[model samples]
Structures are given as structure tokens and as C-alpha cells.
Target: MISVSSISEFVYCPVKAFLNQTQKDNIQTREMIHGKLVREIRRGYEEITKQNMWSIKENIELEYIFSTIFEEVTPFIKKVSKKYSDKYEMDYSVLKDICNDLEDDLKLESQFLSLKVKKILNTTSKRGNEIAEMFFPQSLLEFPLKNEELNLRGKIDKIEVVNGVYYPVEVKTGMPPSKGVWLADALQIAAYVVLMDYELNKEVLVGFVDYIKICERRPVVVNSILHNKLFGVLDDMLTMFEKQEIPEFKLNKNKCEKCEYMDICEYYG
Candidate 1:
């Protein structure tokens, strides 16, 4: 299925996009492994946050709320640590120590959340709580789109209402506000909005690229000109996919050097 990630590859390079679409197996590297770890960690945090929100709605005490959630997540942490240890060839003792360290860090984060809850209660007035509750009410919004010809099917992260305006949000585990952010990320969100509008039959005015690592939210406002450009690229990609032709690599020396498929790429010379 074509994911928002496949859209990102198209922006990075059409040759890479073609390879990703057609290649049976793609190489993995240490960087990709580390990136996957970070993504998993961030996903865990998001899940905990969502559960915490639910607990708060249930009127559970903040201290117990955090403690309970942490307890439930410990097994998951241990499972991930064990998997990481098995995947990497490292000293067994060292791996055990690292796992212990990570466990402590998770505990510290739990304590921090407990403190945050107390602070929120102390600082927020009754009136403020009411306003905040209305603004931040729990909602699950998803945009599912499928294009059989393109072999694409995936759910966009969120379609939320903020201040009565619908916004599409795409989450990422990356640095904040790079120049490539707009050029690459905007297209994916634009595609999501387009698909969503088609499905819902309503126009969405704004979208966001949410960088979790840096806590940055980049706004993306899609207009006709930008949408047209994105559509053109998608058309080219679909054409290449249909023909089963590998596009010629436009050597991006810097990116190619870091790419996992560098060794196999015909243009490496």
C-alpha cells in the first residue's frame, strides 16, 4: 500500500520512488534501525498520552493514573529492549545495563507527567478548565483513502477540528523546520487533504506537519498551484509504476552516500 512515506520518497527522488515501488526488497542500515527505534518510542509515548487523556476524563487521580499507565507499559518496554538486544550483536552485560538505564528513564518520565498533572490542576482556574476541556475534548479522526490503480491504501494521521476549522495532521519523528520540510511534507498532507475532501465532500483549509521530536507544528495551506504541482508528480510516479521501468538515477552525491541502497545503485560510480 502506498503510504505517506512513499509520497516522501517521490519528493526525495523519483528514481528512489521507482525503486521503492518496484523493488522486492530494500536494504536496511544502522540509521534506518535507529530511526525505527525512535519511531517506536515516540509511538509508545503518544499511546500513553492518549490513555492518560482518557483517564483524566474518568476523573481518576493524576498520580495513580500515571503510575497505572507506567506499570502497564513496563512489559512493552522490556519486550522492545529484548528485541533490540537480540537484533544487535553487543556484549550481553552491556545490553542488560542499557536496558536498566532505559527503564529508569521511563520511570523518570512517568514522574514528570505526574508533576505536570498537579501543576495543571494548581494553575488552571475552574473557568480555564472548562474552556480547556471544551477545546481539547478527546476525538479520534482518521482519513482512509484507497486508489487501486496506484496500489495505495492508508489512513492519514488525523482530521481534527480546531476552533471549528478542520485540519489534517501528519506526525513525524524528525528535526524541526528544515527547508525540505515544506517541499516534502506539504505534498503528503496535500494529498491527504485532497483524498479526504473527495471522501467527505468538504473542503479543508489547513493542514499540519507535526514534528514530535522538536515539538514543532508546521502549517501547510494548500492552494491550486501547489496542488497542481503535487498532482503532476503523482501522475509521473503512477506512470512509472505501471510501466515497470526503473527511472535513471539523478545522482545526489550527498544523499546517495547515506542511502542504504547506495551499494546496489547502478549510478554509484
Candidate 2:
């Protein structure tokens, strides 16, 4: 299966993708390790709850959300409660666990919102000094996507719903561009939109790249051009899979230096 991750590697260098699949695991770099840790933090953030400010009208107090949380969570509990019905009070415990999970998630979300506000205040744009608010009103974590016909598959880190529009949100433990997103990152988000569109039968127009460490939210708009690129890359990916031949190495010393496969690749110099 062609992973969304491979698109970025191919963007960086086709040889890197070839090496990534053909070779065994190499030592993870500091950046790689830090990235893994950051992902862990994000994954920990999985649950229901938010310190949402922008979405709700000012007249509504934040306490209203908390008061209604149980009402909102009840349907979910009832839907899944059968699994625990056999045990004594286990179903009740499950409900309690769910509530606790939501509460914890709310705390993390509060922190995240605070950080976002802080960042926006610190930034000054050409238009003038202004603060920005970027948040997901509703989000589903670790969502899976697959297109069997295309032989493509990957898990989306998040699917954020704002108003009624749905978009994928990918968290990166790396640097983001001053303008737009990295090619690989764009491809990944595009793939998510494609898979989601197929599965849901709804058009997914945009997605986000969350550079978590820097607290930057970069939006990626999926267009015909990117879709064409995705198709081209999928073809290339399949071709490489069929041939089982490592593609020619692009002579970029800096790229090689950063690649995990450098130690084992035949052309590394």
C-alpha cells in the first residue's frame, strides 16, 4: 500500500522513498525522536472536550458547555454500552471513564487555545497587528482512510469539523514554511481529502498542517493541480512497487545527511 508519508519522501527525493521501503529501520535522529514524542503528546490529547471560545456566542457562558457535556456524551455511552453489560456496574464505570476522558481532553484543549491566542498576539502581519483564532469545533482522532482500487491507505491524525465543513488536520513535529506547506505535507493532507471524499461522498476542500511545537496552523487547499500530482505519484509508487528497483539517487548531500537510510544506501557519499 502507498502511505501518505511516502508522498513526502518522493517529494524530497524518490530515492528516499525507495530506501524507506527496501531498507530496515535505521537509528532515529534527534528530530525524529522529538517528533515521536510530540506525536505522543498529541495522541494523548485524544478525547472529547474543549475550552472553546470562538465558536460559541458571547452570550453563552462556558459553563453551559460543561453542563451539557453529559447530555452530549449519553448517546455515545448508550451506543457502546452493550460491551460492558455483562459485568456488574462495569457499564456504569465505562460511562464514568468516558466522562473523565472528556474532562482531561478539555484541560488540554484549554491549554492549546491559550497557546494559540498567545501566538497570534505576538505576531504582526503586513495588514496590521491582529490576533487570529484557529480551532476545531468538532474533531475525530486517528481516523482511518483507504482506497483499495488505488492501493492506497493511511490514517489521518484528525478530522476537524467547523460549522458544517469537514477537513483533515495533520500534526507535524517539524518546521512549517513561511508561506504554504511542504510538498509532502500538502500531499498527505490532499490524500486525506481524497480518501475522505470517496468514503463520505462529500467534497473535502481543505485540510490543516499543525506544526505543534511552533503552534502554527497552515491550511492546505486541495485543488485539481494537487489531485493530478497525487495521481502521478500514485502511478510512480505502483511502478516502483512492481519493478522492485530502487530509483536513482538524487545527488543532494544535505538530504542524504538527514536521511535515516544514509548509512546503508549504496549511493550515499
Candidate 3:
């Protein structure tokens, strides 16, 4: 099965997705490790916030909300940082330093989230409890979905149900572009919509890319244009996979500069 995420990877760099699947050895880099730790920390914060949402008073201050969430996530950072440090053979001290940096980053994220919460409550005509339920609709985290007909499968970061409609939400760890989402991200969301359609047996007209770094949700319309583009990429992905041949692509100096498969791609050349 072609993983949904590889669709985005392939869009970013054709060879990247190929190498990701073929490379069996587990190699860890500082950036990769740091990224993993950051994501874990953010997930911890999100889980805590969701768990405590209803319990929080409607009149709660944004700072109070942020502080509460941050406090709950503190131990999570330590636990995961230690786990990754040992597994990757990195110094625990270095990971601690990274965690220190993350403290600032996560603080900013929580603030953004808190502000969003406030905006929703203040602007909406519904009661505070109704606003809470609407803003944080019933959602499933890391929901597994698949389309056997398309031979595509992956987990949506969150599946939110609103007014009897299900929307797929893809959480992105990286910083978003200045304007809209990246092409890869948009396509990935469309791909998830396709999977949701298959799974739910109902047309999913929209999806979302949640840029967690800045706490922004960008909607993706699952229209014909996106469907055409998605199928085009799917064709290319399947062709490359079936032939077991690396497709020719101009090396992106910036991307290749930090790519884990640089050596392997160079070796192939």
C-alpha cells in the first residue's frame, strides 16, 4: 500500500519517497531527533488541553490556560526527551538543551491556541459551552484510514465531526509558508479526503492542514482540480514503485543539503 504521507514526500522530491521506503537501516540525525522530540511535546500539550477543555472556566484568562497546559506538558517533555536520547545515543544534556528551546516555542504555541479559544468564545453567538463544543468538535486523534481500491492508506492527525460531516485534519510540524499551505501539504490533505471518502462511503468535500507551529488551520477544498492533481501524482508514484527505478529530478541544493538520503542519492549517481 502507498502510504498517504509518501504522497507529500514524493511531491517534495520524487526520490525522497523512494529512498524512504527502500532504506531499511535506522539512521538518526540531530535535526530528525529534535523534530521528533518537538512533535512529541506538542502532542502532549494538545492532549492535555483537550482533556481539560471542558473543565476550564469560560472566563479563564489566556495566560492561565497557557500556563495550565504548559504545566501538564512539562513532565511529558522530560520523559520523551530521555527516551529519544537513549534510543538515538545522543547526550541527554543536548536533548535537555533542545527542550529548553522548545519551552519558548511551545509557550508561543499555547498562547496562540489560547487566543484562538478566546476569539471563538467572544465572537460566536452560542453559549460558552456550545462554543467550546463547536470549536473543539468531537475529534479522533491519529485516526487510521485506508482505501483498498486506491491502495492508499495513512492516519489523519485528527478527524473532526461537525454537523454530521467528517473533516480530515492533517497536523503539520513545520512552519507554514507565508500565505497558504505548501503544495505537498494541500495534496496530502486531498489524498486524505480521498481515503475518508472510501472509508465513510460519503464524499468528503473539505479537509484541513493544521500548521501547529503557528496554530493555523488552512482549509483544502477537495474539488476536481485537486482530485486531478492527486491522481496525477498517484500515477507517478505507482509507476516509480512498480519499476523500482528512481525518477530523475533536479537536486534541490537546500533540500538535499539537509536530506538524510543525500549520500545514497549521490551514490546512485
Candidate 4:
């Protein structure tokens, strides 16, 4: 099966994707390490959020919400910090610094969510369950989706059920674009949207990319154009994989400069 991540990587750079398919060794860097830390923390946060979402009261105060989020995520923060520290061979102090910074970030996110929830409560006649469904949305974390007909499969970061509709949410720890989502992200979400549509036997018109760094949620419409592009890339990727052929490099100096396979890529180019 063609993985959704491979589709995004192919969109980012076909050569890089092909190399990744062939190569097994992981080249970890500071950014990669930091990304792992953020992903682990976010995964735990989502699990806690899903569990506590139903218990939230409609008339809950913002401070209460903030404190609840903080308290719920505290043990997780320490646990993830300690685990990363030992695994990465880092000092506890350094992990503490990262945790402190994340605390501020999560606080900002909490404030943002609390305000949204409060606004919904004040403006709408919806009760606690409705409000929870609106924001938290009974999400499935790291949900695997597959479509045999399309020969594609992937694990979405989160699949949220809102108003009886399933929407794919892809969490991005890296920086997002200034406007809209990155093309690679949009394509990734589109692939999941297609998979979800097939799996649920419903037409899912939209999905979301959650940019964690900026706390921004950008919607990606699952339109004909997006589907066309996604399928085109998938076809090319499949052919390349089958033939074991190295795709011609489309030179982007910026991307290539930071790419781990840059030295090996020169041979093909």
C-alpha cells in the first residue's frame, strides 16, 4: 500500500521520497529530536483531551479550563521529558528547559481553546456534550485508514467526528505557511480525506492541518483539483516503486541543502 506520508514526501521532493523508500538509516538532527519531543507530548495531550472532553461542563470558567488542562498534562509532561532525556542522553536540565518552553506554548493553546469554548457557550444554546463535540470532536488518535480500491493507506494524526462527519486532522510540528497550508500538507490531508471517504462510505469534503507551532488550523478542501494532483503523484510514485527507478531530480537548492540525502542525490542528478 502507498502510505500517506510517502505521498507528502513525494510532493515535497520525488527524489527524496524515492531515496527514503530505499534507505533505512535515520539521520537524526537537533530539529528531528525536537520534533520527536513535540509529537510525543502532543500525542499524550490529545489522549488526555479526548478522555476529559466529555466531562467538561458548559458553564466552565476559563481559569478552570486552563488549570484543568495544565493539571491533566502535568504528569505527562514530566513523563515524556524524563523518557526523552534518558533516550536522547540529554541532561535533565535541558529537558526541563524544553518542558518549560512547551508549558508556555501549551498555555497559549489552552487559552485559545478556552476562549473558543467560552464563546461557543455564550453564543449558542448548545449544552456540554454539543460543545465538546464541536471542539474536541470525539477524536481517534493515530487512526489507521485504508482503501484497497485506491491501493493507499495511512495513519491520520487524528480523525474527528463533528456533527456526524469524519474529518481528518494532520498535526504538523514544523512551521506552517504564512497563508493557507503547505502544498505537501494539503496533499497529505487530501489523501486521508480520500481514505476516510472510502472507509466511511461518505463524501468527506474537507479536512484540516493542525499547525502546532502557531496553533493554527487550516482547512483543506477535498476538491477535484486536489484529488487529481494526489492521484497523479500516487501513480508516479507507484510506477517508480515498481520499476525501482530513481526519479529525475527537480532541483530546489533550499530543500536540497538541508536534505540528508544531498550527497547521494548528486550522483543521480
Candidate 5:
């Protein structure tokens, strides 16, 4: 069974997937630290948003909403700071400085949350609210897939129903809309769409890439072109997996510099 992440690894360089699956263990490099930090921040934001819904009440003011988000994120901010301290081997003083900087940044984040809430309320589409609501909803979080042989599964961040159309959202903490479409992310979202479609028996409208760092949301229309491409990638990966032929690394110099497997990569061209 191939995972969406495995498909992305194959796309990055089949050799990466080959080495990753075959190797007993791999060392963590600096690049992995950055990836971890980005993931932590993304989770922090999600928690903040989840807590906001509970704080809402009749005739609630915008300030109250902003405050609730801010307070909810305080513990998370401290937790992230402690994680950085432990992982980076930084002293307490350095950690304090970093936390202070993050606190200052939270002000801007509060404003961003306010804008998001206003935008959701003003828009005729209920997609944003539906997506937000899904985070804390127990029924939605329950695993929706049961077939094990299908070789694909993913938990969508949220699903939005807009004008009778369903769209899935995936959040990221990295720079908003980085260069080139990320094949891994595409496959991940595709897997979610496929699962949802299987359960609902309807075509999902689209998927969204929400980059919290840059405060931008990009739509990824999952048309037949994308669907075919994803399937082709998946089929190729499954065939390779069955054959047990480890692929050769096609190293790109720029990517290798930031890859976690750089130390062990034989083809660091």
C-alpha cells in the first residue's frame, strides 16, 4: 500500500523513497528542523481557530473574538518556544528573546484572524465557516475510510460545502504558494478528495492550499488533468514497489542543499 507521502517522495526523486523505505534509520539534519517548526506553527494556528468557535456568542464583538484567539494561542506560543529551545540547544535567554519576538508577531496574527472572520461572515459562501467548523466537530474527524487494499488514506483539514459543491482544504505553515506546485501536497489533497468522493458518490469541487505564514489561500482545481496525472504517478509508484527496484536519485543541487537525506545521498549532483 502506497501513501500520498510516498508518492510525493517518488516525485521528489524515486531514490529518496527507495532509500527511505529501505534504510533502517536516517539522521535528522538542519532542514528537518525547519520543517518541524513550520508544522508546529501550523498546528498552533489550527488550535487557535478551533478555540475561537467556542468563544463566540450572541452579539459578540470583534475585539472579543480577537482576544479569544490571542489567549488561546498563548500556551501554544510558549510550547513552540520551548520546543525550539530544546531542539536548537539554545539557552534560556535566547529562548526568551525568540519568544518575545514571536509575541510581537502575534499582534499581526490577531489582525489576520480578524480579517479572516470578517471575510467569512461577509461572503455569501458558507465554505469558510464550514471548514472552520469541521476542525472541532467529532463526527467529521472520525476516520472515513475502511478499505485497506486501496493503498491511500488522508485526513482532510476541513471540508467546505459551497453552493452545493464540496471542497477540501489543506493548511501549510510554509511560505504561501511556493515556486511550482508541490506534487506531494497535490497527491495528499487528491487522496482526500478520492476518499470523500468514494463515501459521498459525488465530485468534489476543488482543493485549497492555505499558507498561514503568508496569509494567502490558493485554489487547486482538481480537474481530470490533475486526476489523471495523480493516478499515473500512483500507478508507477505501486509498480516500482512491487518490483522492489530501488530507483536512482536524480539530484537537483538546489533541492539537495535543503534535503534531510543530503548526508547519505549518493547522487548529490
Candidate 6:
């Protein structure tokens, strides 16, 4: 079964998808290296901050939220700190120092997280859309979705439920545009929309791209054109995988410049 992420890599560059999927050995790309850092920085953001979302909606003070989070998540953080320390071969003291910095910063970070959630429910012109009242989509996190017929499967970042209607939401730690999301990024959310339509039994017309860093949730217009593009990519991937055939390289200098496989890519042209 192909994941939404695998499909995303394909969209970035077919060879990137090919190398990642077909290679048996570990090929650490720039993305894989940085992905760890991103995950480490967000250690307690979603898992812990999400627990306080209700209080945030109730107009709870930021100070109160900050204190409550440390009180509640200390034990969890300690356990995680142990694992992270062992993996990185660092002393527990080193991990604790990093955690302290996170503690100092989370006061402001928590507010950004809450603001992103609010912008989603309360429509804004961030994405050039207009509305009076909030859409109030119930935030569903780490939801698993699969479409067997389409051979599509992945764990979704979030599924926003609005008036019993569901929409796929893909959150990013990276910076976002003042408008629409990137094509590769949009395609990932579009895949989730497809899975939500079939697996969740919800007719979702559109979805969102929650740029967590900037606290902006850009709406993704998932129409037939975008949906067809997603399927077309998937079909190509299926054929490549089934026939054990590697796809031809599409040389776009900008993409290859930052690719993890740049040094090792034999098809560089």
C-alpha cells in the first residue's frame, strides 16, 4: 500500500520517489536529515498543546495555559527525553537544556498554535475567502484513513469536521505563502481528501493547508482537475512499482539543487 507521503515525493520529482521507494539501503537525503530536526522542535506542540485547545477556545489566559502545560506534560517529557538522549548518544543533561529552551519558548508558541486553530474555524481573508461566522470544524488529529479500492492509505495530520462534513487538513512546520499552497503540498492534502471521501463516508469538497509556523490555514481547492492529477501520479507510481522499472529523470535544476540524492544521482543532466 502506497502512503500519501510516498506520492508526495513522486510529485516533487519522480526520481526522488523512485530512489526513496525502490532503494533497499538507507539513503539520507537533506529532507530526511532536516525532518528529524523539525520533529524534535515540535516534540510537545501537537500532542500536549492540543490538550489545552478547549481552554484556549474558552478564553483562557496564555499564562495559565503555559503553566498548565508544564505541570501536565513534565512526566511525558521526561520519558521522551530519555528516548531522545539515548538515540542521539547525548547525556540527559543536554536533553534537559534543550527542553528548557523549549519551555521558555512555548509560551509564545502555544499562542501561535491556538491562533492557527481559530483561523481554521473562523474563516478569514488569509486565503482570500470571506465569511461572517466561523466554520467551526471539529479538529480531529492523527486520524487514520485508507481507500482499498484506490490503493491509497495514510495517517492524516488532521481531519476538520464541519457540520457533519469532513475536510482534510495538512499541517506544515514550514513557512507558507500569503495565498495558496505549493503544488506538491496541495497534492498531499488532495490525497487525504480522496481517502476521507471513501473511508470516512464524508463528502468533502475542499481541504486546508495549515502552515503552523506562520499560523495561517490556507484553503486548498480540491476539484476534478487536481484530483485527476493526484490519480495520474499514483497510476504512474503503481506501474513503476509493479514492473520494477525506474522512471526517467525530469531535470529541473531548482529541485535537484536541494535534493538529498543530488551527489549520488546518476541521471543528473
Stretches of candidate 6 off by over 4 Å are 23-43, 50-82, 88-106, 111-138, 252-254, 260-269
Instruction: Please give the clash total of every predicted structure, in order.
Output: 0, 0, 0, 0, 0, 0
Please list all clashing residue pairs in model 6, or write none if there are none: none
Q: For model 3, how does the per-residue alpha-carbon lDDT over 1-269 read when each residue is reduced to its tens digit?
A: 88888888898788878866556246555666676777777768666666655566565677776675456666777788778877888887787788887877777766776787777656654444554575578888788889888889898788889878888888887889998889899899898888877887757888888886676889888899989999999999999999998788877788887665666675333
lDDT of 4 at 262: 69
- What is the Cα-based lDDT of residue 183 in candidate 6? 84
Worst 10 residues of 3 by lDDT: 123-132
Error of 4 at 257 (Å): 4.5
- The TM-scores of all predictions, comma-separated, are 0.69, 0.65, 0.85, 0.82, 0.70, 0.70
Q: Which segments of candidate 1 are over 4 A away from where they belong? A: 1-3, 24-36, 53-75, 83-119, 125-143, 148-152, 161-165, 178-180, 246-249
Better of 1 and 2 by TM-score: 1
Q: Candidate 3 at 144: error in angstroms? A: 1.6
In Å, residue 137's CA in model 1 sits off its true spot by 5.6
TM value for model 4: 0.82
Q: Candidates sorted by TM-score, descending order? A: 3, 4, 5, 6, 1, 2
lDDT of 5 by residue, 1-269 (tens): 56555666777788776665556255555555555655566556666776665555433457766776677576777788787878787567855764565566666877766666655556534443453564434323223442366676555666766556777777665554455346677766777788777877758757877666565667777778778888888788777888997655455887677667778777765
Error of 2 at 198 (Å): 1.3
Best by TM-score: 3
Local distance difference test values of all predictions, in order: 0.64, 0.64, 0.77, 0.78, 0.64, 0.67
Off by over 4 Å in 2: 22-33, 45-112, 115-136
- Look at candidate 2 and tell me the lDDT of residue 170: 91
RMSD of 6: 6.7
- Which candidate's lDDT is highest? 4
Per-residue error (Å), model 4, residue 28: 5.9
